[model samples]
Target chain A: MTRARPLITDLLGGLVVTAIGVAGFVESWRMPRFAERHADPFTVPGLTPGLLCAVLTVLGVALILRAMAGRGGAVAIPILEWPAGSAQRMIFTIASVFLYGFVLFGNVPFLIATGAFIFIFTIGAELLNADRELGLLPLGVGALVLAIVAAFAIRFIFVSVFLVRLPG
Target chain B: MDGFFQFLHAVVAIGLSADLFVVVWATLLGIVIGMIPGLTATLGVALVTTLTFTMEQNTAILVLICVYIGAIYGGGRTAILLNIPGTPANAASALDGFPLAKQGRAGEAMAVATTGSFLGSIVGMLGLAIIAPWLAEFALDFTSFEFFWLAVFGIVLCGQLTAMDDPLKGWIAGFFGLLVAMVGQESLHAYARFSYGISDLEGGFGLLPVLVGAFGCAEVFVVMRQEATHLVASKVGNVLGSALSSFRYAKTWLRSGAIGTFMGVVPGVGEDMGAWVSYAAAKRASKNPEEYGKGSTEGLLAAETGNNAAVPGALIPVLTLAIPGSAPAAVLLAAMIIHGLRPGPLIMITQADFFYSVVAMVFWASCAMLVLGLLLTRPLLYVLKVRREWLMGAIFVLCVVGSYAIAGRIFDVWVMIAFGLIGFLMRETGFPVAPMILGVVLGPILDNNLRRSLSISQGDPLQFVSRPISMVIAALVLAIILFSLPPVQRALGLVLSRLPSLSRKNGDA
Candidate 1:
């Protein structure tokens, strides 16, 4: 038999979807109406979205019920389990992305930021995964060289060949 | 006859010029892009679209088409070498291709894949060349009601076909995507929608950012979750000899090509479905069915042919009806619109030679893939050895650059990140993303046609089902839903088994 998805995940996901859907419904209703413009009744801007929100809400409720049923129908309790090792990797990836996209690119010289990010990211990932036998210093040096070359190559391709304007 | 001669003349002109270099270069670039695990044919075309913005419209489109075709074909190499499909379309290929690689026949598998791709492309090109004009002419009769039905049918069929395991979830994802498309000022009213007073939301989520986010960043996160990746060395031997042996499966090649082309003509079904359905069909018909999952050459050929054929198959609807048959085709449609070539029923009348030009482009791309696939086998195998961590970091940078380059909107970058997270979550769950993409592309058409159909009938919704074409489409949709029901399926199976003729056919088979 297939393993059921944890109850907490589904229940929480359902609640979140339900909240969004209800909010969307309210907002769609609050939008300026076609009555002022004397437009066709069918031409209302909120028609599709209003309908979609209703559907989403219903689906959310169905999901909640399904999760309850999967938990043997009487339990309202939630289940939780943390994955091993993956949480760290996920956190690191998200943080690195936020730093690169939100904080780094426009704030500093493009090559410096990109090179540093790549070098550090590569070295960190290599150490964490530990698939290779190279010493840390040697790997770090190789990563830095690779990062420098990659940064320059990307700049030349995007800026010169493609004529794209890059953030400073 | 005159059109044919003109098309021939155009082909000859292009064949002789420096512009052919564009085809060669794009094909090579496409192969590299496709061989990368995170990058897809859609991304390759989208990235190239930006680079070709300043070129002539014809040349620009040619570059994109070549890249699209080459990328789809090129992904087979990674599937064979790494047991990881370089693109989602190559998933079926990995089933047989990787097993062959494990047996030291990786080069042979690559050769078969290339030959199949070339033949499949030829079949698809023929369909586009001969059928697109007629299909465009027929599409001229479509009204608001028919268009509305077509959009719904596209979304429903895509959801059902792509997410066969759980189509309801597929549909929810699709409708959610449609709602996402409704986030900006609408076309008819110019009224702000789900924007919530945010100026960036009013401008709307650009497709490029959403796509880059969904396919690229999301992929990085998935790879991050994996503990390790393994790469193996492949022996390159007798590529031509192995490729020639694929001729023994010519019937499977042709049948799979036809199946792929038909699937492509169904909007949003595209290469992945084509490859999977063909693979399934080949397995069903094979004499050595037990050999299928364990390294069957015929299985590899069918999948490769089906997907590569789907490239041109996907183009058929785009050229004829301004509707994309697949996600990559949606990007192609967008690129065409940016180049001031609006594809629709009147495209055949307005731009008579465009279809032929595309056919010629596909032909050259096939030739390029055949040459490059043979030549670049060893280098690609070497590339497969690159660690995912470094590559993932590099890919994220490209994603940022690609997202920001579209309209120079910082808001779009944020959208990319948000959607990337959403896409990752969706992947972790069983929800498919392809249908959502189709819905996003088809949302405007659905919205506009629904409103227009209603208006035409003076607020009566019944008119949607009243029109002839609309009725046919509605009936087809209803039929599919009905057949998919478990009780009905079981009943039909029993009835069919009881029928003497069907039973005899089954028994004979």
Candidate 2:
């Protein structure tokens, strides 16, 4: 209905860009130019990154100025208010993804971790839906069946057909 | 003539090979993937790229091309049945497509879309087969300085074209991607520039993981954050009749296909723009323009054909110039590099028949799509009914596998997650991700060439302007920048507007 203001997001994003640019500039400047090896100044490893850093800093300042002037840029990230219970679902999904990739992966058995991830994620998503009536039994059973089929299919394709090695 | 006949022989051989089955199956899978709401053609191709790592290069390339063609054509299914586009390219189709569906002619609309896509692909294939090698031949004269300018031109033009409202944001995203590529050890010198002592960072971020994260994982997050909509279905019609009827408006097909192919050849301008522009042109030329938004088969055909034709259009630059014409083409370019099939000016001379093989692949993919798109329209629509809960879960699994399978490294998976988060945030803030992806793809080329050119010129900045090819490219880049300025554009518009009257007065004299 109403337009969400992007002022805060733009301001924050500009600051982040400016910070990254500054860091990039400093780190690039510190990099060895290896002048003794008779390398051309233009071919110095830091040249492109350093140039990009300066450009990024300038753009960030421009973004900040536009935001301060009340002109349209990134006003506000609507992450907080996509729909009822959306923010929670998004956060949950992201966390589950990270956990699957980082913590569970390489540490646990490949099939078990993948199967559990699919099952839990599916059930978790259904449980988090605010508008739906949660049916635990069907949801659990469905998640289980889908996860088994998916995990096996993935293994068959990647491990068998494609010959990619999955870690336990 | 000899080369052409050889090309035909190769095509015949490939046609009879077992890989034809791969093409058929990949097309069907691509259609199903395209019909899904959260899935995109770019992601489909990227996922397939990971899967193709172990296959023979030719078979792998065949599958990827089929998937690419199928997915782009298949997005029309949702655009017609639901008011939602399965991908950004299908957005234009949804305008007239949904109306046709609501009128209980959904099958007719699907049939028209399939026919339009087939015709568009045919036209684009012709362009690729004819024009691309010529362009590559011409580009053989390009020097280091010319390449530097071309790279900059690509980034700037891409930023401006993809995000008209905020070209600044697009430029920033593009530059950021370039910076990301600048990480790890330098190619010219072994100096570690941005690694900061992290061993994993030394190799830089692999393109596959970042792509999977940005397109795949980010999609998962975006989909999960929204409530799913219900699907609507319609009955069948004579597929041949609906397809043949599109020929009644042959002019629309020709115009739209031309526009789509041309748009595809332009570096970074892609199918979404092709569809929108073609739809607008068709509406403008129509005798009954009022029917455009209310179930006009011509409008639907224009959109579908334009987007699909752009597919070949996008590949033109990738095959000849090593610059991608679209996001999906970006992945395709990456796939080429992964398969050791380098695409650039030297490609024609080094691997002469590679160009013909690509053309053959496009031709086969289009034929496969025509068959599958018409026959399996309803079954593909059935995929739209699959719940978001299950689909997103499956996608996440694929993302994890696709990212890790590239290098069998866990860090790449983390990279995917990180980029996915960044992509999600960037999308929410209206920064276009395509330019950023291009930046990463082109960053090394830009850096290596710029340094080489400057080094060759002994740090003479004027060398960039003095060299003929570089000067021309530099002028084009400058022209693009100037035209992007509102004041300059207005002044140019004024001059252009007075030209007709001035011409008329001269004619009278």
Candidate 3:
């Protein structure tokens, strides 16, 4: 049994883009006609989606051709045989980011969250393939220092100076 | 005359005040940001622009100018130290710079790069001061049709110049970017094109998110996927010796600086093209063209000088015509607008003092770059010792925070992720990202201007060519497209080969 080519993904993406571009072109073409009907012009005059449709059609064709070409040569796709626990570590890193957004945005202070996020991700990744020379203590300290400095710097410069309001 | 004195007073006062300190600090920070693999000069300017929103207009302008100069200069560091260029502008540097590093002349290469960058910037500044007002007057004549052609020219030129192998790929990327820009609401009407009932999509893709995706996220993915390689850290030697060597090759310095400044003046063409074109031109004119990629001091100098000079050149259009010559300049234009400084025909009349102040800022920024470059050479060398994984991890955090911090919206974060994936795919498949970015940046301008021009003509298509500026721009665009054709290029090359008499005439003259 052979694995399926990523044709479904390609077709779905292409169809969606083509439909949107065509719809936009049609709507824009009728805009002037519609504007005349309504006392006030409902559309932007002279800016139709014809150019956009032509460009999109060309792009859609190119994408389909590329997808048909499929995966070529062994060197094209490098074999990345990861260490035993690297996948889990990678998942954890991505998860931490999601969690930070969901849980830590308003409740936890930025510096604390940043420091914790970096420390956790770094430690988790390192644990997969332990290196004795790279001590946890130094890594933790470095991450903390960098995170604290960056958080404060960003706050002071963007908020205090620029008056930008950032979420806690 | 009174206003002149006030401008002079403003410059002197600003120079002596803490504003100078802020400029220096911002320049240093920009250098660091540009020296990092995942951070670019555009991002550096955008980040700093937000930070300048509340400051005095002059101070803000000063800081932004410093960052622009420093970022362009700083990109050379990673290009020299590692084979990987820190920013796209430094890509040409890597061709000669990496070889120089391997041969253990990294310090000398860096020194030459710094000196060349400094000189190039100064020359560009001079051109800006002398030529910008006249150019601005020329730009004042540009109406809607001219602007439309200009935007199209920028996108096409970017595609032609930046694409390594396939110009078609570059154009495709650019078109894709234009398509992306078509998302959200149209500029004139509030009608959403492809929002698909999603409120978040209605706002369209943000510049910060798209930039972060293309530059920062794509870089992270590329680095992660690549096999880990070690760089041989070189010692920092006498930088002054390298600076002195630049003067020894005065011809190369002058030629490269001129090339850089010319490339910079063209709207939408940035420092990357400046560096590559200068390198190619230098190699072609060199006594030994064969030594180009093999640690040639002249090659490295040409690349560095052209890129740095392109920085000030890029600013001329933004200051004069309200047209950004580069992505970084676009961000700078936004910053200027945010500070209530409208850059157009009336700019010189309304804010002559501010214009002069910008010229002064450019001069000061170059000096700051030189000072900081000398001081930071040894210190920044330590960055090479950092582990790739550690650096990547930290950069990842910055990318996330940077994207989210721009607008306090989770939607932007998602946009960043989506675009990051797209950028990664584009890179993996050998599609140039620069064209995509150019398309996104110029899309609205093209759309708006094309519409306006048609409206002015009351739906007459011939109006596009009737205007003088538009005609010239259209002709140039057509010429560029024709030049890209193989037969036309071959014929042109043959004609060029028959120019020995022209060369001899020059020698005789």
Candidate 4:
């Protein structure tokens, strides 16, 4: 029964997906009536629910079969398991990327933001590995150099040559 | 004869100008990008595509073609040296190439790969020149039913071929990709399907963001989790000596070239499939099949030759039929359209000199690949010594920049990050990423054509079966599905094995 829980979970997942797909078909069927009132007649005429319904039906049938065959459960198979603390590192990385996009883009400028992102990320990766012997100075310097070189080269090509406008 | 002279004249004209220098430089830049892990041939082409938008059509075409050739060949370098394939197309190469590197024959492996690539490109070009018209005629016969089946077949085949141990994961991954492709407005009409009231989703997911996120950012996250800081470095050796050894396995080169061209002609399948199929076939045919994954030069040669050949092979459909055989070919087709050139049946009649000029471009691109590959071998080898952490980090930044620069939208950057997470999760599970990429690239084609065909048929379900070409394609699709069944495959294999022997005996008698 303990081993069977995974199979049950997969079955439930498949069922949920099928239900969603069926709901989509139903929703699409109702959409034309609503769209007709709000939208132009030219647009609503082409947005037929038949095609959407057919696609959903097909997908639902496929999913049901896959679940019945015990195939849906197989997607959870792990090739390489992440180490403990890896989740934290991934979260931090994602946060850093978001910061680099939102906060860094406008304030720090492109080259500086790019350099900082590289430097911080490399250091963070090293710290996550928990390798103290390597030290931060060399890695930081190397990353800065690489980031500068890359940023300038990209600017030269994309901006100077191609004349694409980049965020300063 | 006059056309031939004009062809030669165009070739000479381009060859003498700064356009030739641009081609050379582009080829070198492409090689550098390709040799680095996470920078793929597709990305190289896509990035260069935007740059070439401002240039003259002929010069743009030449630069892009040279880059395409150089990048495809360049991926083999990292595969042989670092054991991490620079692109998915090089995955098969890494199987035997890395083993050869470990055996202190890294230089030899690189050389063999280079020679095989050169030979393979030439063979593919010849095929393009000689058989493109006939092939295009055949392709024109393909309609909506055929395209839908082709897209499905590509996804299924890629999944089955890539995932050696499990096919289920492949299908799931592929379906997931299809679902992702479905998020935007339907192609037949601008009706939103899964926009969820979000204005940004109106355009659907951008290809550049999805690609960068999947391959680039995901790779960085995966690498960051690993314990190793630096890639294991191998001693470099004589590249020329290894190239000479490639000639010893001439049969492998020829076989792979044929396989590559065949795979490339099939719409939606590309260099990755070419490499996989060629590698598999070479292994099966070789006396030393067991040595394939253990650094056999034959395996490396087959993989490299197949992928490089696929570069020119992909262009055949684009030049002749106006239909792209692969994703990069689709971009190339778009570029052609932008240049006021429509490639189809009438192209040869309408623009005979332009047709010859494309042929000339391919030839020059091949020559450029050979020269750049040999000259840059030593310096490029040093790149393999870079720490994995640094390399991965640098690539992540490039991915961000590349994704953001595509549309200059913050939404695209977020999309990249989101897809990167999804790609990472998918990798942790058993899903193959190639099918997903294929789905995204081919989704609109399948959707638009299927809807158009149905409209033409007035919603008649049997319309696909009624058309002769569509009927043939439907039968082929059915045949492929039936062939995948174990019992059917075994029976077919038994029959196939006996036929060759019977034919040989009959010939001898």
Question: Which is the leading candidate under DockQ?
Answer: 2
If ranked by DockQ, best first, what sequence of candidates would result? 2, 1, 4, 3
Estimate candidate 1's alpha-carbon lDDT, on a 0 to 1 scale: 0.82
Model 3 residue runs over 4 Å out of place are A1-33, A36-48, A59-112, A125-132, A136-163, B1-13, B227-231, B392-394, B405-407, B485-509
Q: By DockQ, is 2 or 4 better? A: 2
Per-residue CA lDDT of model 3 for B191-257, tens digit only, reads 7766768998888898767877676666666655544445655686777777788888888878888
Worst 10 residues of 2 chain B by lDDT: B231-240
What is the Å distance of residue B433 in model 3 from its true position? Answer: 2.3
Where does model 4 sit among the CAPRI classes? acceptable
lDDT (tens digit, per residue) of candidate 4 on B31-107: 77678776677667765766776788788888778877887888888888778777777889999988888888877
Q: Assess every candidate by TM-score.
A: 0.93, 0.95, 0.85, 0.84
Instruction: Compare candidates 1 and 2 on TM-score and give the better one.
Output: 2
**Best of the two (2, 4) by lDDT:** 2
What DockQ results do all the predictions give, each relative to the true complex? 0.41, 0.67, 0.23, 0.33
For every candidate structure, what is the RMSD over all alpha carbons to the true structure, in angstroms? Answer: 3.6, 2.4, 5.3, 4.9
| CA-lDDT, candidates in order | 0.82, 0.86, 0.73, 0.71
Rank by TM-score (best first): 2, 1, 3, 4
Model 4 clash pairs?
none
lDDT of 1 by residue, B149-251 (tens): 8888887788788778556556667777777887898988998798878999997788878877877788788778766656554577878889899989978
